[model samples]
Target chain A: MVVMSATTLGTLELAALLTVARLGNDAYGLAVRRDLTERTGRDYSVGAVYTTLQRLEDKGFVTSRASDPLPVRGGRSRRHFTLTGAGAHALREAERHTASIWGGIGTSIRPEPA
Target chain B: MLHVTPRMRDCIGAGARARVTAPRTESPPLPERVLLRLGVDPDFTDAVLGDLAEEYALRALRDGAGTARWWYSREVIRSAPHFLRSSFRYACRYERVRLAAFLGALVLTALAVLITLSARDGPPARLAGASDTVIVNSREPVQLPVQVLDAAGHVLHITGVRYQWVSGAPLHMSAAGRVACEQRGDALVRASFGALRESFLLRCRPIRRFVDWRGGLWLAVGDSAQELPIRAVGVDGTPETMLAGSAIVRDSDIASLRGLRVHPKAPGATLVDVWVGGIVDVIPITVSKRVSTSDALRPFEFFASPLRLSSGQTRRWHIPVGSYFVSFRSDTAASATAAALTLSTVGATCSRFGDAYNYFCLAAKDAALVISAPGGTSGAREFSGYLAVRRN
Candidate 1:
């Protein structure tokens, strides 16, 4: 198997990619937004979500296809995103990098007395 | 459970009644015009508006309508700038190239027009005609020479003089100062010399000759023929053929006498005898020879005769180059009462032949008409009609 280069992703890119991967086939614009909001407990704007999705697409971390228009969405196609292998690799690399940075920090700091 | 008194129950009943009678206070839908004016991509606009509407309805049911409305307004205001930016970028992406091409074409057109206008502003020369109006024959070209003169009538030796026909006649000037006339009418020719112009009126008269019903018949049979082989036609104007070995006329004359024979005794007196299909007809033929130089001024007219055809038969008529209107009428009562006869031409084919009479407009030198029964039947169908040339 050929190994692909791992791309560096921002916080929003990684979050969106993770949300897409977790949601699987149901990962769309509004669905991803709701998932992100529920997980982070932060009110994410529609523009911020879509703009981040577009940026991730430009970076080739994710790919999107428009679904057929649904009656509930007023006949507008849904932009559904899927995580690529490169995106999964990048996510693994980011996790590994974060774990390495925090490997000894737990021992160096002590919790406050209860 | 807590025990309730009658007064408490009455107050509770009154509160429930008030709640039941209260009007709904849900927030109204967002204005579609406002969403459209946001200049968002159509897909995004639709999806976003739909998402907002769906969520708004849910929130109105769960939370209060007032809170849902505030949430919707905040979301729309926050997302407006992003949609506007994306829409602007998308529009500029393709429109920049189109705008550049349009500007380039406009500049090229302006340069071409300027060059043309500058080239037309050269020397000034006028055309002096021999007469204001000239008469010519339609059959032959007429020579009308014009001298290229300066502003003071001094002759100028110009090699390239452009000539154009304005109206009334279709005539063009060749290199040797000759006017070619195709049709007979009044026409105006204009000669231009670098912006100076002269107009002349020309009247073209049509030449008179015998109509060549058969190709090369006029040459084969000289203009002064005593007898000619004119095909014998029946009273219904259909060509009649005799049965073989039938001794209706003399054996020697039967072969020579194919059509109606004509004999002119003098300049204005003649006789014609037609015998065909066991029927005889004597028609008088008159020839008048009036010689005049002004004969070209007279209007020309064509002679049209009625022709008859049977089922699955075709007939071709030779005519001059002009417009003609042909009308077909069924002759047989059986065919006419049962179904309409179909008539078709070489150029224009009729869509349907349900009507009794069919009309066609022909604009050719030669036209052929074919008659047939319904469904390509070879029944005994007959039709007689006349075609006349339109004079314009």
Candidate 2:
């Protein structure tokens, strides 16, 4: 496949990568907690940004499954998440396209020593 | 019309505590009074409600709403597990010794219950017969005292005896008068002419063949084969009298039967004098090892107070052997000057047909006594009964 170069992607694109890779089908507040902890080596309480998952779902990058009510979790239904094929395609295209643009740099502004 | 007035609004300050110049942590009276009138502000109302609910829950649990409250509090304290974190961080904090001690106590409690049940089914002194009643003869009536007497002239044991006389061979009066068998009410009295006061339990043999023994005779006694053992006694002053006669030795026919023996411990707690005879075997045991208390009586709650033994004073007692059957007797004043008191074991409770005062206790085992008496002046009172050792 011919690699196309692209650069300067939005924060939304990086999030799309995380959702598609680790949380292919079943993901939600808990999955996001695991993914963020794995990627960043630091824990973030997922309660801070569950609304973002809903926003992503609305934007078509992520899909959600309303889970059954759990007793221990205070009868709250978990909204599970999954990244669509379109989401994965967007992420891979972002990565390869970004790498291609970086590869196409003819020369550095600082000239090479003779 | 009733929107919070400016004064009320100002009084209900923001969620944060209002600062004042005073060093003491006292609320300014004017602002406090205003806030009381307005109640809590709506902005901070949710937090206040939450705090009140939490306090209410805590108080309900601490006051003991019962097991359900305790179970709920136990569950709520547990935190959600962090899957990324190691459980060892929490597990290592528990004390090793405390966990082991709890398990050890539970095992000991279970062991104690098992031992108690096993000890309850131990063998009795002896089994007299397979059935409750054994027929001795076929034709004539017979009479014998169900109670047994010790050599010390005390009643030691009591049991029911039945007799059936055959048609042809009636229990006849011998020339010596030492072996005349006759029926007296329920007892078959085999009175010997030479022997002082002793007889044998006569139950008719099925065939009615005359079995001749050297010295003794069988005197069968009972109202009927079905009647229970009658522990008949009469009290005269300090001692209870067993109206029946004592035990005597016949030939091997009655000598081989195991009979109960009574012994008296000397005042200084020394040697014991054996009362009943015909004990072919004797075994001495350490009294300390033999003495035991009933589980129910060990925790008996005794209260001390002045009391009187009324006319209807009666109490049932299940006492052990080697325990003194003590009864308190109130003595009238010797003169007008001094108070006189005396207590004694007033009855013979042994096998020998004599005084069994304080002798109701058995040897090395539990005995059931039904004592009925009026309550008397309560001080620290002590009673001792039978001390049972193995048959020698």
Candidate 3:
């Protein structure tokens, strides 16, 4: 069995994961770029996002398809990528790892249900 | 609601003006649009980006610029929250004003319309015995624009009408026609050239301040000093006083004179009179701003692929009486003449069709012009080609 490690990712890697997960089936280069821009108020390059998407797909985290191009975009085909089950699992594991490390830390507080 | 800083408001207002004035191109790329949509309301986002886009384009056009459109996306990202708050506040205020104005105007207009309908006469005095005011001034010959509708209101295909400035400058004529005027003695005289005939008349009385009444086709030159109070007579020697003023003359204004116009104050008309020492004849008013081709030509039909050109111009090739497609590309410092553009129906090439696409390519800087014909002949007998190239 391939064991999945729970390790906290850096800000950019974590952001990339969150955007892909937020977009779900619609998670593509443009989608992730838009997701990060909306949630974090930041602009990411399409080429950079696409490259990261390929990296995530190689790690068994996402899949992509060449969708029909919009008429106004000079008919450039849109490559739409979707997060896989592995991606969702990794996101959860990353959260758990962060929580475990910060469990005993005094400054970090987790609110209990009312 | 978001508290807008004065600087932000100034930026937004400037952006709006830029959007209104910018020529239609320079829309943001797809990725930028998507990013803009994520943070701000779509309409506000579009408004802000559109303004920025126009500013970018105008700057590019004026400064001979390169692309810096990424600034729009960066700015949107930086100011998303403030923009959303401002947009929401504006929408609320605008809605309240719009509703009140709409309701109030609707009620008042309804009441006024009802009162007007109830007070209508069987025949209004304004319409009674008031002759159809034909606007014709004859002080100077009227210069008509090419392909203007004639007096019968038919589109007269005047492909060629050339005139040289002989004594005084001539005014530009519109799609309708124009009136020429001269103030002889205390009365102002007007004339208009229509269908190869001149209508000369004297202003007998001012009816509607500036409105001229062409009582007849030709109000002959008249004498006001002699025993005849009505000395003005047409070429037929009929005594007639044109109950008109020089105000109906459209497309021309006395640039030097205190008050003078060539055409009726209608839309799409320019009143341009050159200042020549207070003399109306010294100003050439009827100058056509649009340049037309020497001859009209129809494109040959049935081209599988349009011949490609590097002139930074959009090229379209249509199948005769069929749907057509246009392929356009623009680059820095391109020329229509430099492109080895050749169009062929199917794979076969004809000698006559070699120069077809060259004439159709309209040249510009850092922009593309696309035109498609909707499945019909342009009805041109002979087409001449010209290279419309301009170096920046």
Residue-by-residue lDDT tens digits, candidate 2, B1-392: 11222212323323322111211211122322232222222312221222222323444556644442443333222211221011111112232233335458868999999997665443223223222332332223333323333343344353333333323334642323222323221224333222223334443332222222221111112111121111221111122112222322223221222232322111111221121111121212111112233313321111111223333343333443353323223433457433333222222243321243222223334444333332346653332222222211
For residues A1-114, what per-residue lDDT tens digits would candidate 1 score against the true structure? 534433767788889999999999998888898999988898888867877776676666787777885554444467788887777887898898778766777654744545
Question: What does the lDDT read for residue A81 in candidate 2?
Answer: 65
Off by over 4 Å in 1: A1-6, A108-114, B1-32, B93-392
**In lDDT terms, how accurate is model 2?**
0.34
Top candidate when judged by lDDT against the true structure: 1
Ordering by TM-score: 1, 3, 2
The superposed Cα distance between candidate 1 and the true structure at residue B53, in angstroms, equals 2.9
Provide TM-scores for the models: 0.33, 0.22, 0.24
lDDT of 1 by residue, B98-202 (tens): 434655897999999999766643344567876777655334555566668756566666665666778875666664557755545678887766767788887
On a 0 to 100 scale, what is the lDDT of residue B336 in model 3? 51
List, residue by residue over A45-82, the lDDT tens digit for candidate 2: 33223434434444455665656744323333455667
Better of 2 and 3 by DockQ: 2
**Every model's Cα RMSD, please?**
28.0, 28.1, 30.1
Q: List candidate 2 stretches off by more than 4 Å.
A: A1-13, A16-18, A21-41, A44-51, A58-60, A67-114, B1-392
Looking at model 2 chain B, report the run of 10 residues with the lowest lDDT sum.
B79-88
Model 3 spans with C-alpha error above 4 angstroms = A1-9, A107-114, B1-392
Per-residue C-alpha lDDT of model 3 across residues A9-42, encoded as one tens digit per residue: 4566677878877776776565576678787786
